[model samples]
Target: MMSVTRPYQLTDLSDLMALSATTNCADPRAAYGWLQERWGRVAPVELEPGVPAWLVMGHQEICRIVRNEQLFSRNPHNWRLYNEGAVSPDSGLGPMMFPRDNAYFADGDKHRRLRAPLDDGLAGLDKQRMSRLIRTTCAELIDRFADRGRADLVNDYAAIIPMLAIAGLFGLGPEKRHELQRGLLALFGSGSDSQAGNETVERILTEAIRERRAEPRDDLTTAFISHSNLANDYEIQQSMVLMISAGYETTKTWIAQTLRLMLTDTRFAGRVRGGRMGVDDALDDVLWRDPPMANMPARYALADCEISGQHIRRGDALILGFAAANADSRVHTEDPWLEVGNRAHLAWSAGPHSCPAHRPGRLITRIAVDTALHRLHDVILEIPADQVRVAPSPWTRCPHRLPVSFTSAGAS
Candidate 1:
């Protein structure tokens, strides 16, 4: 392991780009490319203004980081800034980077213990039942705007379906599911309402857990409550939070990005609509070019080390650059023909903490996208693709809105 001889100075910090700012840009890849050109694979980044961390952009470099957890731990307690109290409690990064009882912030044996319930809960899911739920949810949502012939694909369709499907798996009623969806949207937004959203999510899950405990039902919530690994109510509640939030956000983004590609990219538009290329191809392509979670938060250095020639000190934070790594020339090519079925991209990430819900996530996304295209005739973007904006967040780069127009389903 190697270390920098001196601490980073204010002058050094001035040159680093704000990670959130870069992701919020319309052309983030261009900015990421500039970072790679100037700083190589590992570059200094600020999660918020003045808070420094390393953003690992190289495909191989990110692989090395994720696959070797001994050197890089998922536990945020190891983060020097957070530990030193330098990171404000009210900082926008709190909801994401702060320690939680869930598996996302755990490491080693504890991580395995916390993660078991999620895996087991997901394992208990009946894929056939889930697919049907998704299809039904999609139909109901589309029915809202299908007659109107104009829709914001993101809000009216893509964003609503995943949560409703997930809610069905948890056995939540319509009212509760919509409430959970609203809370999660705010929590993931990482804005002023994030803390309030976190509270709302916690309250909802706690109530659901209590309900499941009094009388166990054959649903994911009951499954989590009954899992041997979950020792108490708090653990069970946190696990539910992790599963629902991660699953909803990722699936929503995946559906939106895939639809965005199909409507905007000529290569996909021509083939998918003409039935020349399958929707699955477009989904895979989105995973490579614009993954649901563009930038993930994060891994902390367990010991001083060097990555791609950049010296990192012990307890330093490392943000996973999934979108940037996918764009790495070493692993990915610009040719659409070559990118269609390639699954090597780190979209689901890698290692022990890799996404547990990817299978369910994909199923939900596929059904939502397939149903939308099938029901809507000749759907086209209302605004140019280049003018489309992404929601502001330090992690996850999904379209803010995808307004599209199409033939009314009720047309004569």
Candidate 2:
């Protein structure tokens, strides 16, 4: 089938399909039918003008594609639309959809080689130290607005924790972490200037890599610099890009979504305040309902395949509809009460490409949310719950700003 292209100026945001518009990430129950009614388990969707792909929305079917790497490759080189000259190389989507030397875009032995250093780097982190860093960071962040009695949690707290923690782990100091945060925000924003931001991130990481090589440090950047598998600076830079970009955006969303649930959802609000539901429980709920990355990028089919009766042609791109899969009626129960401790959601994805930093990500989020609630007494949303706006993107769905008001009587 020939690819259909939509007409629009390259500068327009509409030129790119906005995935966040399809459903509400904060409360996905209202949007369950969006994907379910499209095509049984897999649906055809537009990925902007002239680009098309299949979105796998079923739980079991997503598992099949992710687990069976032989059939579905993660390499962007295999994408039919891009390879066939339909999607432009300079298209804003190039950063995510194009091939790179990192594990995110590689497969087989090369994938393992690029992935090992990251796994090892994260494995070596001191959990106790990380906890201290997060608590201290959260405390300081809260202190900034404690006197004001109000703050945009999304920008003031939830948004900054991950980058600070991750950057510290990567061995960057306070100033560099702020710089990294800015570059990352722009890269993930997917706005008209996203490509420029992507290039800036590369330059920042390249400099960091060069500095790390010159003077070794106890950070992830140094680990990547010394890792044997990554042969060049470009490879190391791309690997850092993968780790930082993925870690920052996903964990930020997790923090914001978890906070949203605790503040707005009565079921969780009551439990969290009364000590009936732990922060971990709230975090788990967010994973099932509003995962950090709602719709992951692409997984190209190496050859013809069929999933849930949908014909997948060779070189076709298939998106892992993780949020959709979690809500699949087949494996997921409709009742929230019964789902206590049932962590069957595909939020971290599965198979070889599953998120490796989930442990630390959870640690940062848990500390941030727990610290805020502990410090802020009688916290409440300043605006109506339904008034919160989500950022425009084809990937994750996260609250743009969570303006919250609370009493400081509980502050130490």
Candidate 3:
């Protein structure tokens, strides 16, 4: 398909068949940079595809589309492209969130109903309980390599915390625990090769759902199934999908990127360590500077809408760049491109689907960050970042390996 462009450019629309064509999951930002270069202003620009669609980029525009449920919808196109194949009429994921059919997909009440149980599960911080678990995990990991002076930050440390925390929440066992940490990394991680891995990962989750049903245990999975009033097995499967997607990918990226950012900008790192930049500023800085997911795909139009002066045909798929929009200066007076964080940005999202679990997610992030701030005496990059390996996926960014050295640890 040909790349989409504004009417001013004399490009052939026939070349751009649909939204999927321009998007290369391997390196999405490349195409984003290309499109941004083609048309000016980071506002939601149409990619001039065979099918009429608009990608909301600027901060305000993304906010507009996500909030305007009346006009924009998650199931915009009749067809959605996935790794295996294209799903139409039905989401292929089956009667789940963002249903393809208009009535089910567009109904706000339905969305709220589904989120109710999920919301309840997210409640109850139990800071004392959770903090103890997090610190212990970090301490154990640090002990393993304290003398080695080298560890892969993502695998050896950061990635393990969420799963362990999530495991405690779910009460998963060590045997056949089915670690979502690595699974999600592969699913949304780099390379087309992951398609096969994604399939296997989904299958494992599917099997776990089945086993949990027959022999329900005292865990988050059992709690979710019983609490959700789920219609059938597929819905149960979707919960696993949502939890893994929400809990794993984003958290991993944030940790990897945050450490890297602090490495490059020690001044900022010093501020965080000294309790000067403080928690809110430090977290906000990373949220603005290194958001996990850059853009989210497959938003349906609830009704025909116009954004940034373009007439979007109803039901047309709208692509949104959470990172780009958050970084756009139009919505923020401060120079966002400079990676400054005096102002907040929309990394997770800003509208109805703006991430209901964001509050808890932030708490978990705090545990990790605080562990580093108060525990590790100083920052040490074992494998100079230039030598550290990078994962190839484009939609989300994370370091495959962040070898590092740190002083003997202590607790806050």
Candidate 3 residue lDDT tens string, 29-56: 5555565655533324333222334556
Backbone steric clashes in candidate 2, count: 2
lDDT of 2 by residue, 14-53 (tens): 3333344454454554444554553556766567666767
Work out the TM-score per prediction: 0.91, 0.87, 0.73
Off by over 4 Å in 2: 1-20, 24-34, 89-92, 186-215, 333-338, 409-412
Residue 104 displacement in candidate 1 (angstroms): 0.6
Best by lDDT: 1
Task: Give one digit per residue, the lDDT tens place, for model 1 in 1-412.
Answer: 2233333422257767888866789778997887777677788888887788888888899888888989999989999888989899988888678888789988889999989878888898888888877887888888888778899999888888887788788878778888888888788777799889889888888888889889898789999988899999888877777777678778889999888888888877788879887877778878887888888989999988888878888898999999999888888677977865678899999999999988888889889888887888888899998988887787888889999999765321
RMSD of each: 3.5, 5.2, 6.4
Q: What is the lDDT of residue 145 in candidate 1?
A: 85
Stretch of 10 with least lDDT, candidate 3: 76-85
Query: Rank order by lDDT, top first?
Result: 1, 2, 3
Order the numbered candidates by TM-score, best leading: 1, 2, 3
Candidate 2 local distance difference test against the native: 0.79
lDDT of 1: 0.84
User: Please, what's the RMSD in Å of model 3?
Assistant: 6.4
